[model samples]
Target: MQDALIVLVHGAGIGAVFALIGMSFNVVFNSSGILNFAQGNMLVLGGLFAFLVLPSSPGIGPWFVFLPASALLMAALLAVQGYLTLLPLRSSVEQHSWLITTLAASVIIGAVLLIFQGTAQQTVRSPFPSFWFLGTRVPAPYALSLLLALVWFGLLRWFHTRALTGLAISAIAQDLDAARAAGIRVHRLQILAFAISGLIVGSAGFVAAPVIAIANDSGVSYVLHGFVAAVIGGLGSDLGALVGGLLVGMISMYAAYTYGGEFQDAVSLALLVAVLMGRPEGLFGRPAARRV
Candidate 1:
């Protein structure tokens, strides 16, 4: 019973992280129908950036100062990359083209991180303290991840409800042609969505790396799991992405707990396969209508 409860808590924590990541990916997928393969790279990039900007590292300023600084700077830089790389693709262009382009971008960004950061697996000293709940030990970074998710979701819910820009972006995602007809600047919205999505994904790196050690290839699994989370949750629903990520996270965490840690990847993939085959539309998503 104790082991079960611990498994649950740890799984839930991991799920929370993946949930946020899925939300970030879902935003871009829903907005532009682009897979944004580079999302994982953005996370790794942010992690590497954190390594560079920390006080103990080769950077200036206090550790506290560098955290936010690195976060904001990385987000901004990725936003610019979002603008430059994705904004130009016409919404009418084939999604495959965008997929290829973005996949290439992911490779490029990942390679760059590897080139600079090397293949070392390293840990980041977090600004938060670790805690235990019901005999389940929790890392500070995971706790921080939960807090970030709450704040980000709260802000997103609020913005979507009240902010014109946020609503416009959501509207564009919902009905691009209708949004255009209503005088929403589709191009600008796309640009904005890319930037915001990049920023969100970048922050995933910022917070998550402290919980798990980061490496040159750290991003591949982070992103692959994120895709599973987003797909299983629902490609079109933000809430679905959150739920999906959490589900995937829990599966991997519990699998590793009960089984061997080495089986984590295979278990995660198997779950993804099972979910995809069982329910393609996902838990909260609506199935597409068949053409007559």
Candidate 2:
């Protein structure tokens, strides 16, 4: 029973991280109709920023002072990156340039971090302390991570449903021509998507740094797993991304717990294959309708 509970907590924590990444992916994809492969690196960059700004060891003083500062800096930098990505393709028919641009941006960011942080693994202590709950131990970082995920989810849901800007972005995602005809600033919204992506992933990294060691090469792994979660949840569905992330996290955790850490990737791949084969649109994804 204790083991089961532990698994559940750990899975939830990891799932939240993936869900955060997945949602960031969806935000940009929905708004711009482009997949930013650099989404994952935003998380890495956030961690790196936090590492340099925040204290190497966790404490309330350092966290309170540096967390927001680091996050803002990361967001601004990534927003600039967002602009660079769309600059070249704004008037061109080559819509796929985002693939190269975002990837290149990610490489550049990684290289920059590598130059400063080196190849060493970096770890930080959780800002919050662990506590016991119902006879099981809960790590503070995991709890904080899960809380952040839930909060981000609720806030995003509200934003998309209630905010005018959010609705405009959604409209653009549904039909760029219609949104433009309605006088929606499609270009501005795309930039907003990039900024929001940075915000979400950057905050997530700030919280998740304690749990996962940050390294220069961690971005690609995050991209792969987060992409799988987003794909599994359906491309543009936030709730789908959440569910997919939870499933991926649980599967990976279970495999590690049962077989060994070495088999976690294998299990995740197998599950992705099974899901793709069974439901191409994802578990909660809606099917497209065509009108002749």
Candidate 1 lDDT score at position 50: 69
Tell me each candidate's TM-score. Answer: 0.88, 0.93
**Root-mean-square deviation of Cα positions for candidate 2 versus the true structure, in angstroms:** 2.1
Evaluated with TM-score, which candidate comes out highest?
2
In the range 1-292, model 2's lDDT, one tens digit per residue, is: 7776677678877888888888888888888877888877788777766776666566788876766666676678767877888887753223788888989987987787789889897877777887887566777767776787788778888888899999998897777778889999888888888888877888888878877658878888888788888889988888888888888888898889889999988887888888889998877777766457
Candidate 2 Cα lDDT to native: 0.80
In model 2, the runs with Cα more than 4 Å from the true position are 90-94, 133-136, 289-292
**Candidate 1 minimal-lDDT segment of 10 residues:** 55-64
Candidate 1 local accuracy as lDDT?
A: 0.71
The TM-score between candidate 1 and the true structure equals 0.88
